[model samples]
Target: MADASAGRAGAAEEAGPSIRTLLLLAIPALLIGIASAVVLWLLDLVSGWLESAIWDGLPHAIGITSDNPWWILVVLTFTGFAVGLVVWLVPGHGGPDSATTGLSSPPPPIGTLPSIGIVVLISLAGGVSLGPENPIIAINGALAVAAFARFATKIPPLLIITLATSGTIGALFGTPVAAALVLTGTVAAVRNGGSLWDKLFLPVAAAAAGAETMHLLGGQTIAFHLPPYGTPNPIDFLTGLLVAAFSAGIGILAAFLFPYLHAGFHALRHPVLLTTAGGLLLGLLGIVGGPITLFKGLEQTGELLAHPGDYSAGMLAVFVIVKVVALLVAASSGFRGGRVFPAVFIGVAIGLLGHAVIPGIPLGLAVACGALGIVLVETRDGWIALFLGVALTGDLTLLSTLCVIVLPVWLLVTKAPHFEIEPKHGLARPPTALA
Candidate 1:
């Protein structure tokens, strides 16, 4: 018995970070978390101020509202040209093209951070339809890695990336649970000997700090005031499944169109022209979809929820279609942003449409299922999709249903092409000016 106990102790000690090491790691994790939240908060604050100035102050001064078609066109086109100049003339070319990357792409070189920050702010303030997730994650990850490499030389780069990624996600979602859920599959797949929770310890700690800090900083919450989803029935399940499948199909279709759009835009062969044309198209889309379809879609989601009666079934359908195309264009045309936020908006629109068409489905359930399906396709992570579905509606009753709905949706997208662009030869660089 004594020998067995000693053997077990030895094995356990070898399996994971010791308590002391964990404690040491926790210090930096907390710091990184707090820093990440502050960075996100600052970026949002500046962007919000800029967005207001451009859309409100400038437009009013010019004797036109922001929603005027000409104003939208001019601002968006100029935004593209400005962003293009940054990519063309600025160093590091605003990091890698956002279309070719995902939420967890490798950190860009430290030098690229400035240009990335510039372009992301422009996209946000200019009413581009993409989210800040991808670029912000890249920025934070690169900074964390560089800082740790300089000061804490012993820490691995990959660990820094994980911590920063978790912290940023926590800040974005206003909860550490989001970070944990999003990272579960990746963490579980590692060939490490420690328990999964043990492996998750530092990242979760960072996420917790990030979430709390962001909350203190007055970051907007992701939840909505939708009607509750009560008991589920067989018919509800059938309708929910259909809604989820339909929404996922939309995302899958967008994914199918991604590469072709990316290739066509790249064929323009100059960042200035490609992004300018891209922004022009987005302006046209905005005109058709209205002001509600603009920006990253978070604020727009709130608007849609606050006055559901204002939009008809047809308008809701139009919102879905327009936003999907907008997301494709923004992502494919060298705009620096993430696809997740716009996708969430698309999902919400689809859900509203389903409810309007059926009238029998609960609003909360429809929205949750719709978000689940489209987010699943955009993120390719069941956990994130499930989290967003519940988070957006703030209803736990839909959890089991979403879990079931995600299965078939996952199977449908599992074999489909991902919503990312791959370079035909080697890694595709940002397009430079034509000689």
Candidate 2:
């Protein structure tokens, strides 16, 4: 009698996963959020350690922190060589091939984990001009899928993807709003034809979760404290219009240059050679650009926006031109990164040019406002543009100033077809891509 009962239970268990199986797999969504925050925190921590090693131990190294210009050519060439060698020798030499290939249909492939780790550690450690967030998203998403693979039931992949993505989104930005907007837009862009309402759900939760997580971890929450209701000065509005259009033009040109430069690098077919060359090129640019344009634009943006008094009009204009060029080169040369910081840097330079004419606005505040205003025109996401620009300067009182300039600038950029280029990797071939 006992034997018979045991046999029946075994049969049911083998039949299929219970509904609880899905719940168990999906519940890790919160963990994913925590994990995402942890990774960024660690990235920050690790970067500090490695920077000390390079600066103290490798003094002869050009631009220990800045991408040194005098030796930029050398650094770039060596980086290129190293990149090529790694591709030839490493387990996942091909990487994700996202440049010409387009976004991976999946956020990341399980097989590329080893290479992803290598690229991230080295890029961050070497003081390469890049952001960790892109690879962070890809790696986290890959890990999420691998964990969920053990489930026996037919769990929807989309739900799992959304959950894992939200986790990182919430963690990294500290404000779910920015992370949700960015990640959700990316997911939607890659996944064809998803409805508006469907896309909104994950981000909304992630955004809320991000804020809560920030509070939990004792991080600052960002917001706008506006000036009283009234139209901005006519001069401010006109200046914003000119600056917005100018910076956006830089962005459009940068986008156009990416593919060509990426293709040029691919012709080498050697990751080591490619990355080394990129590194050296960055070093040289740093020397010439005075280290202002080196590395990812995060810390640099803060300094420039905070102390606009340091730069002359000629220097600001030069900074904008060189920084844009260097970003195109680094990304195109097979170096992994994000453009948010770089974009903000360009906008700040534009702002400085304006302040050259009207110095009363406080160089820091002027540069900060203009940076946000231009990024709004370039990216066309008013919230993010505002968030990045204002958030960088540690000020929100200027958001009203942002409103005066960003909208009109965005409007002008909208009519230009160059704003949205067709995806390089071919569009979905079969109608059933979601499958």
Candidate 3:
């Protein structure tokens, strides 16, 4: 009896954290979630205010409208210069080259958070085409790690990373579900002795808290009220597959171009020149694609969906192309941001184009598949791709159809290079040449 009891205790210890331990961890996880959401909310609040001041107030104060081509050019160029100055002069150089970082990359030193925050805000407010997700995650993760190190000395750094990442993802997407799906692969890869959900407990708790906090704070939803996808038909499957595959192909092409673009821009050998040149190119693209093609693209996705009838097939194609280029430029040119949001916009445009070209396919299905393919290629996470696809449409009915569609899309993208740049040196150092 004594031997058996000892054996049971050992097994339980190896099985992972006990229920009591997990429950205790949940408390801190919840707090982390709330804090994470607040950080995101604050960033959005300040960025939105600054965005309005630049695009609305300043434009109105000036003689020309905000959308004027020259004004767009000047604003973007100036934005690049300002961001470059921060990178060139500011300590921490804005937390590594955004091009070379992933959404869940290890957090930069806590001291760098301020410069990262500044560049992110400038990029966001100045109509740079990247989203706040990457930098915000880093910022939140660093803060969480620092706080834990100071206050909860016993908490492991890896666990802190998971909690912070889950929290921020939940807040960004307005749902804990997104956090769960995004982290599924990571958690499952661990060879620990816990049930998957058991391993996920703390992270999920943090994600839920973050998501709910964001909701209570009135964060915008990613879903749009499109016509529901009621039933899946044979033709719908074929169409969905095609759209997904097509979007994946486009994403792959962009991925192929990404490294070249990074190299070309970095060849400028100066942060200010590279970013300013990038801004000029973005300005020209904006003039061609107009204001709708600029920015992180969440609001523009809604606008595009709200008035889908106003755009033609050709124009929709323009939106996709221009946004793709803008995403590449913003990312490769030292701007601090994420690719997912702009990729979402591109997927939406591609879907709309499919619908316009082939009126037989349901808008919701096309859009979902489009987003799935692009997101799958970018993030290389099928679960997240599927979640965003269904979440964007807010239709559970498409889940089965999307599950099928994603298989071939996955096959299409599985072999493609990921949409990330691997820096030649440590963390893509700032170019040495000042000019």
Candidate 4:
């Protein structure tokens, strides 16, 4: 018994790093955070430039106006061809189909980073209904790991991954606490004996540095400008619950359809044919939904909210359908990106529709519930979903309501299929993927 105790103690001591070592490593972690933020900024700049040129400038240069539906179709179809060419011919197959992977999944080889970046940039610029979060994280993670291995061999690969992910998350949401909230569940699930907060210390430090750097460099926030939800009435709670539940149900339905869409797209068995078809479909959806349903939805979200009165419930419903289908197409068709931002847009539309129909519920609360439901369904992480709900509306008061609202929604989606793709190895049965 004494020997076992001694062995366990030794193992614990070895597993935990000393404060001095951690503090010493903080410098590199900070540098990594700064670098991650810079990479995101560069991606944003380039994507914005390309999106403007390809989606707007080129068409205008040819005398096409924004109202012309055929122009959007032509541009998106061409985008499909371009991305297909890159994915088919480029090495690393454009860095794995994102629909099949998690945000923190192992990155591809460092040599594949450039190709992945190019592909992601093309998707982002081409008005695909996906965000840059996943690919950017993978790109920064791979580069950070390689860079650290050269000079900081003592640092564990796991720690490097955590720091890079934290930094990228901070940049993505424009706040360190965003990273903290997103990772809290992951850190808590670790079996190592220690305070969860202690495990989070280093990663939080990196996130803080990353978030601050982005802020200093003019990082934008996704906060919606809306009137605050006044005193919470009992009826508001029921409305909130209903809104979240309905949105979650919609998201789950989409989740179930995800794998089939993925399989059908891959049925082409060639990247060129698969991605080009996906692009053409996306273009058709865009033509049906118009310009608002295109893009990653960050800027489009604001545009939608800017004049909520401009759109009817039917129009908002169309937005929801088009964006959801576009997101699925983009993800399944081998585009490199994340679903969070597009989900946000869809949630916003859901919230607006809820408010329009109900008329008694607060807009802010409706939006929060909408975001809460969809994000929870997509991420399967309660903390992230709640945070997104409150964060998007810039209302901390909504947290308590969301806390209660996420319960039933969670129950509904707990055993449902995840929003990820099936693995290639076929060894591990994905949580609820298609056979």
Decoy 3 TM-score against native:
0.96
Query: What TM-score, computed on C-alpha atoms, does each candidate reach?
Result: 0.95, 0.75, 0.96, 0.94
The CA lDDT of each predicted structure is: 0.90, 0.59, 0.90, 0.85
Question: Compared with the true structure, what per-residue lDDT tens digits does model 3 show for residues 1-435?
Answer: 999999998788658768899999999999999999999999999999999999889989887788999989988999999999999999988987878877778788999999999999999999999999989989998999999999999998878888898899999999999988877777777664667888788889999999999999988779888888997889999988889999999999999999999999999989899889988888888999999998999999999989888999999999999999999999999899999999999999999988988759999998998899999999999999999999888899999999999988888888899898886666633221100
| Candidate 2, run of 10 with poorest lDDT | 426-435
The C-alpha stretches of model 4 lying farther than 4 A from their native spots are 1-16, 426-435
Q: Which residue pairs collide, candidate 1?
A: none
Q: What is the lDDT of candidate 4?
A: 0.85
Candidate number that wins on lDDT, 1 or 2: 1
**Which residue runs of candidate 3 sit more than 4 Å off their true CA positions?**
1-14, 426-435
Per-residue lDDT value at 331 in model 4: 91
lDDT of 2 by residue, 164-189 (tens): 55666565556666655555455455
**lDDT per residue (tens digit) for residues 1-435 in model 4:** 999999998788647657787688788778888999999989998998998888778878989886478887877787788888888888877887889766667666898888889988998898888999899988988889999999999888778877888898898888888888877877777665666667777778888888888888887677777888767888888999898998898899899999999999999988888888998999999999999999899999899888888889999999999999999999999888999999999999999999999969999999999888888888888888888888888888877878888888899989988999877864332122100
Candidate 2: stretches off by over 4 Å = 1-27, 60-77, 98-105, 151-155, 183-202, 207-231, 358-369, 373-380, 394-397, 415-435
Native-to-model Cα distance after best TM-score fit, residue 268 in candidate 3, in Å: 0.7
Better of 1 and 4 by lDDT: 1
Worst 10 residues of 1 by lDDT: 426-435
